[model samples]
Target: MATWGPEVVAGAAHLDRPVRWLHVAEAADVGVMLTGGEMVLTTGLLLAGDEQAQVAYVESMQRADVAAVLLGLGRAFRTTPAAMRRAAERCGVPLIVLHRPAPFSRLTEEVHARLVHGRFAALNLSDRIRSSLTTLNLSGAPLQQLLDEIAAFAGCPAVVANLAHRVLATAGDRNSLSELMRDWDRVSRQVAELVRNDPVTVGPDGWIVAALEARGQRWGQLVLFGHPGSEESGRMLGQRAAEALAMNRLLGDRDRGWEEHAAESLLSDLAAGAARPEHLLTRVRAAGLPVNRRTFVPVVVREPAGRAGDKGDRSDKAADKEGLPQLLDRILAEEAVAGLVGSIGADGTAVLLSVPHDQDADAALERVAVLTHERLAARGRRAVVGAGFGCTVLDEVRRSFVEAVHVADAALAGPAATAVARLRDVRLRGLVRLLRDEPELQAFIERELGPLLENAPLLAVLRTYLKSGRNKSLAAQVHHVSRPALYRRLESIQALLDVDLDDWEQLTSLYVALLAHEAQQAVGPEAAW
Candidate 1:
């Protein structure tokens, strides 16, 4: 951009060679710039006219690679020095003598304006390209799409790598570039060292390297293998592109956060039966959560009661869709029940879970409870908790949640134990044990209804319904109920047992066989179901 054209040369009387501008303010500094095509500019007050002084100036200029020598003619000398011009000519450098004082201030202004204009033009182009990329929402667009754009923009191959130098994405001459980056780990380390020297590198042989950075981290290096005309210009463009690409990745991450949240919520709902279990299971599988015949345990937690001085912060107890489920998954590991729903309740968390098969379900659940306590404790959280054994059916699971909640409440009220207690441990099974000790209690039930009393009315009805070959009217008449009422009662019994009565006739026969259980209890005391 400097005014180094022929017109500037024509103004000089004796300078016929081209002028390559090189500022030389120190006499000893010429050796640093010695690679040809340069014109040295200096005040020339250092010359004392001795032959040694003339030779020193001439030799220094020649060594420093100046194409010409420019001396201000307005200073002490009335005419151009004869020896200096001769010396410059002998060294194959033009001698430029300024007559009538050329205005350096004007020359500097022109040169600066041209340089600023060029930089501004390049910046404006970069901005336009950035705007276009932004409009396309390509910041985190697929890596392939970004690479294709980069390749197209550079008119050459482009590659994106991670900190480890693994090629994350590439475009244009992918085959060649991928092969080059196959040892990207080594290359990245080398590139990082190169970066300390300069972000921009132009080889003596026609190669350019534009260091790439994202989020202040050196992600990788970009090589532009071609002639270097405007090396700085290309570097500027590449920098803008790299920044845009980083921004794109940030935006993509932001959007993915929302998506992951939604997914967790949906899966949580399905696992809890708030939504259809089948539908949610499908979704879980799609999202990569396995749901096979895994044993599942459900846990219910009670949210903390707001104390008098407390400002409400139940938000932590809400199904966090994030931290809590992931924590549960980590604790459950392979034993985790399928279709697990982790929800934050008013005073707790409800987890519908699955686990692997085990002989002692109680022992298994106790271990999980211990792990759960440990996990929550590690996070400095203490919520009232309960867990239920894994169940195969949905109805059994729903009832189990209620039982688990009761056990959790009981556990919280008493001493804290690492083991999870089951509802059966505290309820039906406990009651059955107590009643099994007394024969008088059992005899009273057997005397109430004779054959039906021995089997119980519900059991007798179920047996009649099955023996009559699933005939509703015959079964209903024997049980002394209308047809519709019999169907309703059958439904009720199925609900009570938490099993499908219609699933098998053998179950019906077994119901009949168990009829004399109460009478048998009279013979030898045992618990009744």
Candidate 2:
């Protein structure tokens, strides 16, 4: 007690240790009755004559991990004991001597009251955080919104990362978060492994980390980057945030992994135009995709047409295998490309690549395509990659995604020789695929190819003949027939459809009808008129 002219007799360097509580005891063996972090108060009357007992007392306090030992003068030796002081100094335990008589009861009451109040405040803050997070969870807020709330409470950056240490979501000041994410891959890997559930400061910048686990499995970590508050409060906030995230994951599609789910959610929303441009931009930025002044290229990759099967089977097999989305993520990371990749529907993987405005978008797209093909080839898998026109404006990216989907569909209808098939590569087939659902096109296909639809052999012959530029010998070779046999079949086809195969304009009409019919067939039987 400073009021009683207290003086630090030994271990003054450890005076700032946290005091969990104040204990007033006169017994030399009182250390055995106290737990750690208690500031023990005593008059030392029991150790007045026994030097060995005085040394034992200080040694016991050190063993019990007491914050400090307060020895009052006048009742014991009227001065600090040399044996006890030496023991305290040796043990490195703070030992304070009360030169004037100090009231142990009053000091204990005041310090205990403060400690209790502090604990109560901590509990209250904990409850506040829990209640707020619960409310947000109940309202079905997205993961990013929940992270934003955590960052606001922490007054610092908050990040959610998977077991692989890849950052999935982040919330904080825009500039600070951008800077932090610039080197996130390296910085995140440097974080020390968390052995305890409580938030512990780690890394060179002292990031507070908490594990996000559920059902006895830890999937990710919640990190408070550079929190500027007391460690106790930061731990409390981190724990609550981690709980919310785990709950959110559980309530979400538990079948999908967290990273995939995040990417799917963001990219799906952008593609569907379900979210505003500003909102989508905010989400992309928070998801660690570079958005500011970047060129956005929407790409879709899917299995070739002949390989596509039942939706459920494709989805299950893709889930089991190294799917396109995972492959794209790996390629992007290796190439140092900033992008968001995710599975779309059962047969296609969607990617939104972000390139710096100063970079060549075409070159970047080509690099990604080449890398994707090489990796897929290594796995004995092949996919058709379709890329849309790059856009510098964020809002136009959604249109690009739609264009990519159309290009992918068109590429599936024919043999795509290139690694990446763009709009021009798909040519007229792409346009017909995009407009295949129009009623006029459907009617036109039915009108032009109505009779051929019922004659499989004749339809095949006609298709071969038209595709071979009306060259009878080539068509005969393709159909495995002599020239005379092909001519007889062509005459039967001309008689049935009442059209001349030799007329260029009529042949052109027939070819367009064939293209539309194939596009409709690719869509399934329900699409036919």
- Superposed on all Cα atoms, the candidates' RMSDs to the truth, in angstroms, are 19.1, 10.0
Task: Write down the lDDT of every candidate, Cα atoms only.
Answer: 0.53, 0.80
| Best of the candidates, lDDT | 2
TM-score of each: 0.33, 0.60
Over the stretch 1-529, how does candidate 2's per-residue lDDT look in tens digits? 6889888889988987999999998887898898899999988989998999998999999999999999889887788899999989999999999988888889989988898998999999899888988888888887878888999988888888887777788788766776767666666766545435444444335478888888878877888888887767777787788888888887776667767777887777665546556445556755667777899999988765335332336555555354677778889898888898987766778899999999998898899999987776665566778988999988888778878888887887764688899998988888887788799998888788889899989988988887777788998998899999988998998998889887888888888888888887865311121
Q: Write the per-residue lDDT of candidate 1 for residues 37-92, one digit (tens) a residue.
A: 55555556666455567666777777766666666554644456667666766675
lDDT of 1 at 301: 54
CA displacement after TM-score superposition, residue 511 of candidate 1 (Å): 37
| Residue 267 displacement in candidate 2 (angstroms) | 3.1
Off by over 4 Å in 1: 1-147, 183-193, 201-230, 249-529
Candidate 2: residue 231 lDDT (0-100):
69
Error of 2 at 156 (Å): 1.7
